[model samples]
Target: MDERSQFLADAAAQRKERELNRVQTETTLKLQALARGYLARKKFVSAVRSTTSEKFSAFVDLEKSEKVLLSNDEVLKWSRLFLRILRLPDDNEVLALLVPDTSYFHWTPSRVISDIISTIPQSLMYISGNRVTENSLFLASNEHKPLISGQALNALFSILFKSVKNDENLLPIFISHVLTCPAIVVHLNKANLDNFLNSELFDRCLTYLRSSPELVESIEPQKTINLLGNVIHLGYLDEETVKNRIVDWTWVIGLVMAQCTEFAVRPGEQSSHNHWHPIFGHYRLPIDPKLWKKLGGGSSSEPTHTAELEKDIPPTLAAIVCQLYMTALSTMTNMKNEIIAGICREDRTLRQLWSYLVRWGNQGRYVSSSSTAPSPLNAALSLMSCPQSLHAAPLMLFADAAAIVISILDEEELYERAVPFALEELVHIARFCNYFCFRAVWTGYVDDRSSDHGLFASIHQLCMVLHVRDSRRSFVNDPKFWLAPDVKSSILMGEFEKKTPRGVLLMRRMSHLVSLKERMLLFRKFVSADKNSNESSATLITGLDEAGIDQDGVFKEFLELTIKKVFDPALNLFHSTAAGVLYPSATSSVHEDHLALFQFVGRILAKAVYEGIVVDVQLAPVLLAAVRFFIQILLDFVVCN
Candidate 1:
């Protein structure tokens, strides 16, 4: 029985060994097939690389070598190789491959080529570290000139929208590159912009902006706003289209306001003081005697020559832009209060927008002789005067907006139409001037010291505007004109009557000036009495009883606040140990912050004197305090050393 069992076990072991051998044989066959296939693919890829390189090299160096004209099948093969190698292509290799002529073939298989081109932008979105994709797309547009056609632009826009949708951070770079591409601009210039605006791409962009409020405030939106400006300039969209698209108008206004707010205040380091730098001084006119003589001899009268130099000319691109903004403004019916708030906010975006509108309108005035310069101030006033609106709301809203506008105007331009408009419109002017006074005082205490000069200059300009050279024409000569009981009441009790402490001070000053109308009458009498006198006149007092009121008290308080808010912080910074160390070849330990304060205080004092806002006697204490502070800083530095 044992012998029989052993014989069965041997047979079973033999059968199992045979089964293992059969499985091993199948595995070896599969390995052999995979190796053979990989080798075949390697050889094919090598051949494709060598052949494409040779052809592209010949094309790029055609001047040195014969032009290699490939057949359609050969070109198609090259395109297929590019598609396959799209994972990673060498820079020199791809540039040589994507020459102007070779890029033309990319569009032959329209659907396939479009799919391939679309992938590039996606690849750009994903593999941000890769330069090949960006280079490939740029080369296609720049060197190959393939993106000029409507089909190509549409494809590019689709790709851009998709990529930006996926990663919103890429919106600015994508918009900047795509919208400003020379080919795209050229195409849009000649092509119908309305078609592009009406396309799916435009709709997608509108949706994107609507969805992303953060994007509306960023620098990215400027590109879109600029593109729209170009479209309007090119006359692609008519008035109706612009008006009907509330989304587009709101987006643009928000963008403009955002840009304005961002750049409202010039950086302290880049302030106008830098214009006096040695390197930059060459660009400025020298203060030579001859230049002064020439200027003195020039016309002292108003600028009689309008900015328009040519008559019968068509409206300019700037004029069209102005018209577009005006249209947008008209449609901003519900946004009027928001717009006023934006203007009055410290960001100064509204002020910057106002300046841009004026600058563009002025530029347009030069191009189209018949076109009137667009005035943001005028537009806001017109909105205020709109018959459909309640009078009180518009009046208060526009009063604030006008204050911001007036605060930023160039000193020379202050007396132009703005002052005249204020003079003629008594109800609005009273409110406007009241706000202006508040701004003047608030800015003096809160803004940079250099800016105080402008405030003083503006005040001086206002005084000049009110000066009665001709008594018959002077508004001040007529008590009913500016000093009406209703106007005085409105000025005193308006929305901003005592909103700020500084505002209260301003109102007090205004109240005193308005209450003493006899002083204005006396000044008018003195002015008319000595119209021919070349001698400097005496200070015109309102009256002895009123003069006893210490108006300088407000100015003194303002200077004290400036010392506390601006000077003390600077003094503390300057007295720090880090500020005591001198750089090589330095003469003193005084830092720029200290010097800036000195210059700032000097300018304020000088302007105060010039504007007759404060006398030297009143400024003496402020100057003494500044000098004593500087002396203390110097003593600290000396003792530390």
Candidate 2:
């Protein structure tokens, strides 16, 4: 209210306003200077681009077709522009593009390209492990050379091995990309890789991959596992280069390493390796008290992570090589479709793709097999890599391998065959279950388990995994059979069948998965008036109680059986019922095929239980095949006779 006080406050306000205005004018002046600098840089870039475009346009030598291919040259132009932005002086990326030509396999790079390359520090671009970039150029889009033509495409990828081996900076990038990039993967996998593999480029990768202080990581080590999966993606290599070098035994001994990738579960121990999933289930492995000390190991007091694992020598990678093939097989399948769909049929990489598949299946783990018999399933997978002429041999062999595993049970007896074979099946089944789990993933029952990063551990995924693992051949729910439950229950199936447990008391957990109506029908068998069907529940119970049983095997078998028999109540309603659809070239959705295939497999299992014969122990699809050229050849000979 006092005039003198108001006047003092107004003068202070005017001083503050003047200071703010003075600051704004200075900032505006600085911004104008910066803008001019940026515009000059932009103008210089435009002039350089115009000059490059004019240079390309002035080429009267281009054929009409060549002009069309190079006319847009968007990818190249942008690549060069980006190279300039990085403050590089010359057109090295373009030169890098020209080098992959088999025609120029002898030709040298442009002097400028060489200079640029030489100037680039290996420290910034090295591909090997234990490295990091000062600036992250690893997945930058500018360096991406999409495989588009014969020599261009070939050189693009062929040089990747070179970049990986010699360009220390590029190695980690390559591995990281292979483990992550969907597009580059689509392209590299597309090439028919036989010839390209072991080419000087690939040979280098093999040499390095095989080199010691190999790539294997400590089990779930503190370091991030983002790149560990790339191992399963590569297809060709000598043992020295691949299996012996990259696998870790602690992880290999079971499902831990198997879980390292995006796959469902470790294909049955791939044992020549290990199972990542907790296959032991409710059955704990009973450590033979004396044997532990005999092995010079744990008295149950030693830390589980003690260095003693070296004594076991770990599961060799060879046993699970087949499973690894399956892992790569899907990648190759994607490449074949996506890459070649845009390019030619006979390009170098596409041709090499053929070879990679053959090698992919057969390579990886003799080290794994020494400790256990080779998996027939693993052997069966080798056909994915074979040349067309040799396909039949592996088919026949895979069939034999599968049958051998199906017939045997005891690991001691299986040491030479059965256990390994079953483990191999487990691997494939694990992959299949993973496939199912992802498809059937209980989404928004939580926020899409698929995006959970840890969805692999979700109940829905684990359940589908266990379901697929325990069942021999499930196509969905159609008639998927549960033989006993595990081998223990499988053995008891005959005795169970003989007594028939009319009231559903014996295997209540499993039968409960079925409806009351279905259980009632099954129960009717026990109380049947026919003498053959009379209740022998007492005999079944007594047999089960006859102590001194193999405890681990019993529990494992029971758990597996419970998994197999427990189906979603709606499983039968989801899949098809038609017999023809079971083997359709391309059936409908996975949900549609689930039941019929499940049921058909269930029927085969029922027969196996009744007759005590191994149900078609082969991995090849030969049994249900409708046509046979070999049979025709045999018939022709018979007619001539």
lDDT string for model 2 (200-316, tens) is 443343343334223423322211122333333442233344444344321222222323332222223333232222211111133223212333320011111313322443323
**After superposition, which runs of candidate 2 have C-alpha atoms over 4 Å from their true positions?**
1-118, 121-164, 167-170, 178-234, 237-313, 316-641
**Cα error, candidate 2, residue 455 (Å):** 23
478-546 in candidate 1: lDDT tens per residue? Answer: 554333233344444342333555434444344333445544454455565555474467775555332
Model 1: residues with Cα > 4 Å off, grouped in runs: 1-112, 119-124, 129-173, 176-195, 198-200, 216-241, 260-472, 475-481, 484-512, 515-641
Q: Which of the numbered candidates is closest to the native, going by highest lDDT?
A: 1
Which TM-score value belongs to model 2?
A: 0.27
